[model samples]
Target: MLLKYIISHTRLNESSVKNTIKLLNEDCTVPFISRYRKEATGNLDEVQIGDIVKYKEQFEILEKRKIAILKALEEQNVLTQELKQKIESCIDLITLEDLYLPYKKKRKTKAETARKNGLEPLAKIIMSQKANDIESIAYKYINKEIKNVDDALEGARHIISEWINERTDIRNSLRNQLERHAQISTKVVKTKAKDEKAQKFRDYFDWSESLQRIPSHRLLAILRAEKEGFIRVKINIDDVRALERIDNRIIRSNNTCADQIELAISDAYKRLLFPSLSNEALSKAKEKADEAAITVFAKNLKQLLLGSPIGEKRVLAIDPGFKTGCKLVCLNAQGGLEHNETIYPHPPKNDSFAAIKKIASLAEAYKIEAIAIGNGTASRETEALVKKIQFKNNIQVFVVSEAGASIYSASKIARDEFPNYDVTVRGSVSIGRRLQDPLAELVKIDAKSIGVGQYQHDVDQNKLQKELDVVVENCVNAVGVNINTASIPLLSSVSGIGPKLAENIFNYRNKYGVFKSRKDIKKVPRLGDKAFEQGAAFLRIKDAKNPLDDSSVHPESYKVVEEMAKDEGVTLGELIGNEKILQKINLKKYETQTIGLLTLQDIIKELKKPGLDIRESAKVFSFNQNIKSITDLHTGQLLPGIVNNITAFGCFVDIGIKESGLIHVSNLSDEFVKDVNEHVHLHEQIIVKVLEVDVSRKRIQLKLHKK
Candidate 1:
């Protein structure tokens, strides 16, 4: 029954969802199931598999709640057969809670006090609309506690109010009304009007918009403003209209009993129903906003992690600065720090000639093929200095983003790697490695600190972390990892290799040289057969005895490749990377009950290009040398820029200035660009036309150049 419900909800094939859930129950990771168990899952991708996992967990939670509710009802002696059937059949939490609300234990409310005064029969008479003279009926219940007819009727009205509040149909109707018609409004705190810290939220100080239509970013901003006590927020619908809908449902006639019921309905809506439904509406809207924000953050993190890499090269990296001189480091091809120094070329201590001579000597001495300059303070001036130097070898200079370099520098990972070096030297090394391989270096820093997300801190932290972790895992597996050189963090993101095993692998490598083959990974402590089965395919080995081990081809499929080689009358090495030989082989012949056509097809592709880095190589980008700051930008001036950050509204471009420019969605292209990523990507270099510049606000607007 649960499987059928999940299939209906996700619109997925029943067989596939069933098989996927079975595999998930067996402790298979998403990457493993999506990549290796494709035949079982009918070729479901990671996203689909992830959805199945999420929904299965959600349904399990719901079932547990139902069990607890049933047990509670039984303990209270209120579990009728009909009530049990209704609870068992209910699928949604809201309706289940609505049914359970009246039975729930509560404090001594006014209604409970009235029942204690022996007015239950009078309240029931009024609710039935059968009492013509409520005063006489009420006077009969009057005693020492209930003094007069007025007091008795008032007590009965309180009991009726609780009845209206507990009615499931009435609560559901009011909830629907609030969700459809509620509006969110914010007002600035008068005392905080002149505070400098509150100035950032000026635009949201007097904002009002339909709760359903407010954009995720705007809503998050308003919520943050409210959180910081700069503004007060409220969500409300038309009270009179909501009350009328409730009245129509409760009122059957216009007699005295009906008049008393009307009073109860008004009291119920004002004191109980409105607050409950309005809060529920706001909670639901916030949840939607959080999901949207987390999605954006996940997308941006994926693009940034999978950005172009420059491959292996000896590099000279500079952490640019003014008063503190430019911190420099020379990294080997494998990104190991060979040497470190400082150059005071910018200001305060302007030793230009000395800095130039030292840089030239270092380039020759270290054979630096490329120079990576941090795009931070004094970045443009430092780039100019590096460009002016006449080098012995052809060297390309790139301005790499230094968003989380400072954070990483002070982190424990940095301290462990470079205990003798200060933050500046460590930061320079990070800039260099980021150019060599973005995915390997970026996994060291937290995704939130990468500075590419939209309101990352304002969203749900746990959900954001989970989504970002999935993206990192997908990217790491998509581009296979080098088992010999991958950091503990990067290796931890692989299929089944978590932090403890990652540490073991790293420690094993450090103690017993580099990993000679994928099989050697088993020798690491606590890495069992299951871990190897899930992780071996994604971990690549260079110059291994088995050529397939160096590629993404799993070790279990080595026999299949040997068979293909034998059929072709060639050696394994000869059969690898020979497209002519690969194309001649029939994949159907190798398919076994365990291995399907999908896995065989993937093997053939891997044999075509053994251990290919799918990511594009980084290209040299040059900004408009004349434009250094926002003051130098002019409207209509065309300049080269790199897309730095993307949001729902638009993309932010780094035009080699301290302040990045925004290209609003409308200005992204001449045609309608529904998705920003469809037009531009993170770290993509493009030419843009400056539209406007606001010096006071430090905002620059630009448009994508047509040509």
Candidate 2:
């Protein structure tokens, strides 16, 4: 039953959805299923498998709600066979809640008070609409609680209004009206509109847009303004049209009884139905906006985490500052901190010659092959200083972003990694290590703090974090970690191995020496067979005796690879990277019930490039040396820039200045750009033509250079 529901919603093959659900239920992570269990999932990638997981979870929540509603109906002694079947067969949450609405418990309401005054029978009789003399009928129900016939009719109208509010057909008709024609309108709070903090949201002060057509970022911005008390947001629809639809569904004839019913319908529409349904419409819109914003954040984070790595080069890193001087840390090829010191080349100290001599000496002493300068205060000056010096070796220089360096520097993780060092030294280490391996260094900090999101604080934070975690896990496993050298944070991102298990692996490695092969992971305490099955393939051991250990091939598939090597009449070492031999071997011969041609093909592909980093190697990119700030930029001047951040509306480019330039979606190309990522990505080098510069606002407008 769940399989059919998931397949119907996902529009995927029945067998694939069914098999993926089974794997998810078995606690298989997305990376594990995407990489090692390709045959079971019919070759579904991480995204497809992730969709299945989402739908499966949603189905479970729906079923749980159904069970609770059923129990509530049974307890109320209203559990009819038809209602039970209706609730059981319902698929969507809205319709399910509609079915359960009439039976739901409520607080003290006018309807409950009317029922206590013995006006419910009168309400039902008037609702029947056959009685012409409704006032005469209302007279019989009058008592001390009702007071008079008019009072009795009033109480009965309240009961009828409540009944109208609970009717599924009437409520659904109004819902359809709101969904199709609702417009979100906002009015600025007069006192707060001119406040300094409210300037960013001024565009939304008196704005009105169709709810269906509003962009996610725009909606989120309006919502943020409303949250900050700068504006009042309302979901507006034509009340007359909505009320007429409800009246046609409930009223049958034009009599005094019909008149009373009309009053009840108006009371319900104005007081109960429109309020609930309109809020629901707004909430649904907000949910969609949150999802869109989260997806943008997740995509940007994935690109940032998977940015090119410089590949284990000895780096001299500098956290540039003006008055406080530049903090330098020299790291070895493996990213171990070898030495740290402070150099004052700018401002207060004016120690340029001495700082230069010290930097050159440190480069030679530590054998620094590259220099990573943090792109913060005094970055351009420091870069110029480094370029002026003459080193013994040809050291490649790069300007790395210091987005979350301070956050990581002061974090508990950083303190644990460097207990004796201060935040400045630790920050310099993070900057240096980022150039060495971006993925490895970034996993230690929070994904949100990395500064690649649009209105991140306004969206659903929990959902944003969850989506970003999946992206990080996919990228980490996609690159394959070296088990011998990976830190605790990187190991924790591996599929199925969380923080505790990561710590255990670290402790085990420290006590028993480095992991010799993928098999050694099994010896870690509490890292059971399940974890090993999920994570072993992503953990590489460089120079292991079994060459397959260092590749992406799973331990379970090592036997199949060994058999293939035997069939090819060569040792495993020779069999690996032998593209001609690998291509000539037929994959069908190695296929089994558990392993199909898809799995075999993946194994052969991995054999060609064992544990290869799919990301490009980081290259030296220099911003135009002449442009130092927004004042230096001129219209129509072409400048080299790097795409530092991307959003749904546009992308931001760092053009060797303190202020990054914006490439609006309209300016991204002559044609309409549906997605910003298609035109640029994080850390991508490109030449952009400056369009305008707002020195007062510190904003730079740029266009993508066609050539």
Query: Highest lDDT among the candidates is held by which one?
Result: 2
lDDT of 2 by residue, 1-707 (tens): 79988888889888889889888888999999988888888889999999998889889999999999999999999999999999999999999999898889999999999999999999999899999999999999989888899899989999999999998988888888888999999999999978989988888989999998899999999999999999999999998888788788878998889999999999988889989999999999999999998998898999999999999899999999989899999999999999999999999998999999999999999999999999999998999999999999999999998999999999999999899999999999999999999999999999999999989998888888889999999999999899889999999999989999999999999899988878889999999999999999999999899999999999999999999999989999999999999989988899899888988998999999887889999888888988876888889999999998888889999988878999999989999899998888898999999999889878899999952
**Candidate 1 C-alpha lDDT tens digits along 656-695:** 9889999999999788888888888899999999999999
TM-score of each: 0.97, 0.98
What are the RMSDs of all candidates, in order? Answer: 1.6, 1.3
Alpha carbon lDDT at 312, candidate 2: 80
Provide the lDDT at 161 for model 1: 89
Would you list the clashing residue pairs of candidate 1?
none
lDDT of 1 at 598: 97
lDDT of 1 at 175: 83
